[model samples]
Target: MSTLAPPVRRTLALTKANARLLVRNRTTFLYALVMPLVPMVIVFASGGASDAAGANAVTSVLLMAVLFPVFYNVLSQVVTRRDELVLKRLRTGEVTDREIALSIALPGVAIALAVAVVTVPVSLVAGLPLPSNPAVYLLGALVSSVVFAALAFWTAAWTRNAEAGQMTSVPVMVLAVAGTLVAAVPDRVAQVLEATPGGAMYELVRTGWYGAGGVGDAVEPLVVLAAWGVVAVSLARRSMRWEPRV
Candidate 1:
């Protein structure tokens, strides 16, 4: 008679199993843990504690943390499990569909959260200024993780296999990175890009973490991110496949 709800217990069990599998995959595990730290190298090399540098560093860290661990890893796991018939088998069990999907997603989401937590201390050690709005920064990270995870499921809907993920993942990856470069683009184009998922992420960092503007300034980006998350989740629910694409 466990005190935990049945769903929680089942989801936890599934998550533990999935986490073990992820750990056994040395390549992906290493990528999820190490790749996000790569941006720290750039921050160090630049040798500047300027506001712009700090903002860029924070943005890059958040982006990398979510992109690989939360987004790509989830995409890969979903595709692999579906192809292996693991998802299909799970569906025949006591676990619900949402539980199965969440279990697959939880491991990556945990890793992303760990990285986000480590980032603050690392930033201080690197001589970057503390985020003026730590609450917003953390909220942004949470939103980013959920948004990317949903996007991964949507992407996995069409992904044939883990190998095909490499090609299929490019568009979303590009969209994410493109947002961080909005400052370099023309104003008109930047406006459009700002509405994109990546663009919204950058905006959150700009107004929330960097404190470039007031709380009101953070509203638009938050709304943009929320919209993306809703859309991605809806699409995933509709299109996600339990069986491998033949």
Candidate 2:
């Protein structure tokens, strides 16, 4: 019988409003939820051929899929709020900038987590096995979510409008997917991919799920992920705008 703290409550309110706005935009909602999953659905519909890659590959792809909705949805929140003058009013409140950023990200994180949960059982039935190391899988997913959300906030600062924001996010989404696409290549190429932002995490989660080991195994990817985290947060803090874009 405990109530949510003020910050958490505020975050929830922001998320709820953002969701309502999304639902009202039918086309955007459709694209938000559907586009990223096209690859997954196509693979699964083909009788889970690529799905045989193991739990790590399946979960990695699914986590990457969450990026489509989370980044765009959160970026759209910042852009739309600026247009509505809601962001301007928020600046006058006692709310901290970090809190504001978290509130904006709150909805997308929830959605991603829900998708992670829902996708697990469905993935198994589709031929991808359950993750052998669930903790590592969940940790990688969690880290990926925060990294993307922070990156979205960082981008939203430069965005002049919703269209501009959408366009800007395209590169990031491309980078993330391209980074993970290393799985389709040879081991040497994949080793290179393991150093890129999402690539390392993909390999990390995959190996961890499949129970691989070595001293440097966790070090490289963890370093890369942490570096991205620092970069994303610093950019957001340095550039976030509270006033209207105009």
Candidate 3:
């Protein structure tokens, strides 16, 4: 009476499900659209355009704002949804576990990439330059999005309810704000932040823009991120619950 979906078809369906949900949620749509732009607006108004010192901080803030949703918010929701039976339901159908997880993440990547494309023209119009080395920036975005999504999936496994996804992801938000302060605060603080998760994203992006050779400073954080990625993916496989509690 019924047929099974191919793995690729299953993956596409899940990815579509993820994107549609975000589109339908008015609050989420607003947050995704406006949040990333807020930091850049604030930085420019706060005099970030005045000097090189401010440039590092501005770059960090802008990227973090973009990353928060792509990484923390979306990934955390993926985790929570799994616990709530959304992922489990899909499994009873045609999707494999890998397909489900990858699908959950694909929407965020697409949205973030879209935002990057749109933001570029707007940013250049507003005085930001086209990055001389676009590869590193693109690489940084891809890496950060994937890494954080995995972390959120792991975090959601431990989270009790869907609401906790927001609370649990707070550390990420705080760090993002702190990266912005790198413009206003002392050098040591910003440098220290560069060693954290999204912290290195800021560092890597700045290096891409200016070619100042400072991206090396982010190597330590990059290693830490990769290590975290391994742990998160492993945890998701071993501990991820694919069925609702009976």
Candidate 4:
């Protein structure tokens, strides 16, 4: 019989356990599955427009598909785990902190990836054009996931518990949801939102989908995302708690 490496086995077990927990948790279920699906189905049923605007609309919906779960669901799980002493116990085991964090993040990441994959065909069927630059869109999606996951961890440091997670998560969620719709607002508002972390992600994916801008267009958003990542990582490293607060 073949034997798996110790690290691999541990990661698999942790991921599997977390995945099951996510599935069983109704809140995670709604965010990961039900919430994303509602918008997707709405977009699909609307039979997307046949223009650049239509394509942008599709892009926004797809971004939401990735954002909600990765942002909210992961935030809840991380804060809940920490408050319940799950992360503390895991830290005492052979598992590294990195492994534990990744395990906690795995379920939401899987859901985001699945939703993103389903978006392509759904957009096509809804009459949106295929991404003119697939690589750029894919890269944007990846960067967004990583940035949001880092932010989730950073936010969880102060979240206290799963119930408080909803309150703490509001600022970022509003930023993301508003960022996706900023174009519909006035130029001044759009410009302001564009400087936000979610705005950077929304612009990156939208620009990538339309292939409207040159390399210069991609550079700014990439820099914005990187900046957020750095800040979130630094803060999370400094303040994230493994033990429940008294």
Candidate 5:
């Protein structure tokens, strides 16, 4: 018998199968692979001369990576599989709900991480300063990926179909983008935005990559992200659909 835990084995198998399907859908795969890198144009355009500019560029790239590859992709895949009865059938088997969802989400998560890894070298090559605290930067990337993945699953619950994902995904995207614009917003609004996922992520990138503040400054954003993750997971568990919405 395989020594690996049953959940791990099942999740790995499902992830492999899903990854194959993702690759076969050349359009989605291409978007996942390519879209995250588009914001690097910011780095090059600004000449990456200042620490603040480097942090902004990296934040933009990471946010785009999580938004499209992790959040949107997972939302589309989950909705499509549910509509197709794939998730329904899988639920009838030995796989647990958590395993199934994790499996479905893993590929996109991997893509987001790959983009993060590439960002380091790309930042270096672009004349950007090194991260002041690599640990905080890494934690931010990992937590952001999880938070967005959970949000995607929650969003998938209401999505009518894969086609509807584009429309359904807009609110979160807007929130994420708005978080990045804190500098442009009023102080009261910026405070509220800072508590949002995008705002927290932007703060993390700034603190982590540019030494904007010490690790102490990461506490609030980390807490905000943790709260969002908890809420999103709870909602997804309560509302996630197995069969089509009908």
Candidate 6:
């Protein structure tokens, strides 16, 4: 008798299904794709000459790209799925909670990566300096994605419904955006902001863009990001509901 596929394969199939839904949904299209492109077009056209300015602009846009898929999209989708009883039904299947969560998260992560890839060439064409250390820049972007994904899951745990998710997601989104924009101000305040998840990500990416020395330099921001992820994952596991909240 034929047997069902392994959990990994099933998760991949679920990812594809989720991705299809993402593409068809008009609201998802607005936030995930169109939103990032709007700022990108403006930045690309305005054009900064200095490397520092260019790096800041490029990183800002990248952060915006990261925000939608990793934070907004993931939170909205997860909460909606739970509200609709999809998560409860999926729990009866062979797929573990981890698999279910990952499958749900896959579309956003994939879109974020795709945006990062395309943004690189476009930024270069727009006259921004290419990251001096391409590998490190990519690493920073990947870490940011993971960190934000965890944050999304954590935030969704408290979010009551799809509409509530929009309100709930704002604080984290504001923190992330504000951190990048304020990263340049010199003082203890900047230092404090640097400790935030968004700030840590901004510093890491900016450092990489400048081709800074050994990875040792990045240890602090990496540690901060990892700490946030740990906390988020713990909270998500404890609080995230499989059934609709009542």
* Candidate whose lDDT is highest: 5
lDDT-based ranking? 5, 1, 6, 4, 2, 3
Per-residue lDDT of model 3, residues 169-198, tens digit only: 776567544654544567888777655665
lDDT of 1 by residue, 1-246 (tens): 799999999999999998998899998898788889888775565335666556666778788988998999999999998999989999998999999989988898888778878887787777766677878878888888999999999999999989999999999999888887777789999999999877887787777766887767888988999999999999999999999887
Q: Candidate 1: TM-score?
A: 0.95
What lDDT is obtained when candidate 1 is compared to the true structure? 0.85
Lowest-lDDT window of 10 residues in candidate 1? 43-52
Q: Residues 1-246, candidate 6: write the lDDT tens digits.
A: 436668878889889988888888998868888776666774586366655566567667668777897778889889989999999999998889998889888888777777777777888788776777677677777777887888898899889999998799888888787776544788778888888877777677667766556566777888888888888888888988888888
Global Cα lDDT for candidate 6: 0.78
Ranking by TM-score: 5, 1, 6, 4, 2, 3
**Pairs with backbone N, CA or C atoms under 3 Å apart (clashes), candidate 1:** none
Stretches of candidate 6 above 4 Å error? Answer: 1-5, 45-48, 213-215
Candidate with maximal TM-score: 5
- Per residue, candidate 5 scores C-alpha lDDT tens digits across 79-150 of 999998999899899999989999988999999988888888788777787788888988998899999999
Give a tens-digit lDDT track for model 2, residues 1-246. Answer: 549998777767776877777777776576656655555653355334543255335545555545766777778888778777888887788766767777777666766666666666766666665666666666666677788888888888888988887588877777676666666788898777666666866666665555556434756676777788789889988998776676
Tell me the RMSD of model 2 versus the true structure.
3.0
Model 4 over residues 1-246: C-alpha lDDT tens digits? 549988878888998998888889886777778776666665565465534455446556655655666777778888888878889999898999888878877777777767766777887787666777777777777777777888888889888788888799888777677776656778898888887776786677666766667545888888887888898778888988888877
> For every model in order, what is the number of clashing pairs?
0, 0, 0, 0, 0, 0
Candidate 4, overall lDDT? 0.75
Error of 2 at 87 (Å): 0.8
Q: Give the better candidate number (5 or 6) by TM-score.
A: 5
Of 1 and 6, the candidate ranking higher by lDDT: 1
In angstroms, give how far residue 88 of model 2 lies from its true place. 1.0
